[model samples]
Target: MILRMAWRNIWRNKLRSITIMMAVALGLTAGVFASAMINGMMQSRFHEFIENQISHLQLHHPDFVGQQEVYQHTGVPRDQLDRVLENPMVRAATVRTKVHSMIASATYTGGVELMGVLPENEKQTTGFHNNVVEGNYLEKHGTNEILLGSALAEKMRVQVGSRVVLTFQDVDHNMVSAAFLVTGLYETGYTRYDESFALVHMDYLNNQINIGNSFHEMALLLTDIDHIPAMTKELEVMFPGLHVRAWNEVSPEMSVLVEAGDVFAYIFLVIILLGLAFGLLNTMLMAVYERTREIGMMMAIGMNKQRIFALILFETLALSLVGGVFGIVGSWAIVSWVSRVGIDLSAFDDVMKEIGFSPVIYPVLETAFFITLILFVMLTALIASIYPSLRAMRLNPAESAKR
Candidate 1:
């Protein structure tokens, strides 16, 4: 009976009721879309940056990461690589030899991190072929050719077919120098990597260091990202002589950024709910004022005070339910559109790449976000009605009727 009365009473003030519903709906919609978009952009950037640039997993000698001075100290043997790659979860693997070196071309010179990679295997693991911008990826077993990042090429004032000399310390602590012909140039859209790293055929690097069948690091790709922790544990158990780290473990800064985005989303959600709470509070207070005479008449006719309170509470709950349902449905429609079309960041490509992020992102909406949003809006509406409902119950029939 109270629900029927509350429902009929809401129709008596259709304009005000609709205005409050619109405010609640808009608030909820903004909250849902904002959270989804930010989270989606962060996740997309993280996956591309980590998977394409940094492999899912890395194997190093116990002290290799700390003292990456030479390619030989933390070198993993070629024979051991085959055993590690036997795991079903391992999709691909590559061996790398890295050293800090000074590169010179004609009149220009700059310092770079020289990476020695196997031409054939590196592509299978790192998407190195797709990142090539100007020329082809390195050729197998080639000694005189090298690939330069676009920024590095510009720094050294060199292009394809230019000769450059690279100087670095060998495994024996002796200075090693080699001349390489620039066969290709690549732009990864990541400034830190493109400007700082150079790739060379592993054969030349091994010969310079006088080391055979050894590498500074072994990078691996997994078929599924969820299997990273389990596979890392397995690798550790299988090869207790080596150190293993997942991409998230290797890149703590990126992980923190992803987590921080989530925290911010939650904070914004609370702020939106608070605003909706105030809106609901105002509406419930107005409804109490407008219906005072009607409520007093019911009390004068011997209606119980508790029954009057229940009627007010029921009306508030009905309004909340209607508004909450519409808000959730409307948000779903907006999120679906944005997720499909995506928000473009092409104009900010240079800025994003400078900070080690991908330029384009697609939004992802999760079920938990939707469910939590609905519950929060409904709870806020209920809480907002408490004071208004109590005030109506405390009114004296004589005083209210006189007014």
Candidate 2:
């Protein structure tokens, strides 16, 4: 009976009821879309950073992570690497030999970390070619040519086909220098990488360091991201002498950004929810004022205060449900369309790249985020009705009748 009365009463002032519903719907739409877009962009950026820049996991000698400079002292053998890669969780693996060196040119000289990679295996495992900004990737099983980061090339005032001398301390602690032709230049948008790293053929390093079949570290690419922690655990148990670390573990900056983004998204969701709750409160408060006499008549006619309160609560709940349903459907349609087309940030490409971010991002609409958002909006509406419902229940029959 109370529900029927409340439903009828809402239609008595259709304009006001609809206005309130629109407010709730708009709030829901904004909250859902904004949260979904932000989360999607963040995930995309993190994934790209991990895939293009950092492989999923890395294996280092037990003491190498701390004493990375002493590559000769802490080298992982080929036999041990073969055993680790036997795990099905490991999708691809590559060996890396790193040495700090000074890259010198006629016009410039700067410190750089020389990364020796197997051209064929590195290309297949790391997609290194896709990141090349100019020229081509290093040839397999070749020497006398090298790839320089774009920033490093610019600093050196050298272009493709130019010659640069790379000087470094060999495994015997003796200075070894070699001059190689610059084959290509690549930009990863990260200042540190672009300014301080060079790629060389792995065999070149072996010859320079006089080491055969040895690597400073092993980088692994995983098929699925969720398997990282599990694979890390398995590697730790199987290879107790090696240290396993994820991409995020190796770089604290990326981890911090991911954590901060999650907190920001939650804060935005809460703020939108609070705004929707206030809108509901306003609507319910106005309903109480307009239906003062009606509520009093119900009290006089044997409807107890509990039923009166239930009536108002039911009205608020129905309004929220109707708005929530519409919001979900409407927001979903918008999100789907936008996700397919994508939001372009090309105008800010240079700025974004300068800050180490990708400009283009496509948001993903997850059903879980939508469902949770709807439930939270509905809960807010229900909670907002408590005070107004209590006010309606406290109305005096005589005073309301006189008014």
User: Over the stretch 1-403, how does candidate 2's per-residue lDDT look in tens digits?
Assistant: 7689778877788998888778777777887788777777778878777777678898777776766663443355555766766888877777888888989999998898888887766775777877788887897465867899887898899999899998988777888999988989998766667887899987787678765678877788888888999998988887677788998888888899888877777787798778878888888899899889878887887889999899999898888877888888888888898888888888987776777766776767678877787778778878998999999999998788666
* TM-scores of all candidate predictions against the true structure: 0.92, 0.93
Query: Tens-digit lDDT track for model 1 on 1-403?
Result: 8889989887789998888778777877788778887888788767777667778898888787887778434555666767867889989888888888999988888899888898777888888878888877787475778899888888788999899999999888899889988889998878878989999988788788776768888889989988898998988887688889988777888889999989988887889889888877888888889888888889999988898888888777777778777878988888788788877788998897887666666667788878877778768867887888899999999888767
Tell me each candidate's RMSD, in Å, in order. 2.2, 2.1
Instruction: Look at candidate 1 and tell me the lDDT of residue 331.
Output: 81
Please give the TM-score that candidate 2 achieves against the real structure: 0.93
Q: Which residue runs of candidate 2 sit more than 4 Å off their true CA positions?
A: none
Candidate 1 runs further than 4 Å off: 302-306
What is candidate 2's local distance difference test score?
Answer: 0.81
Overall local distance difference test of candidate 1: 0.82
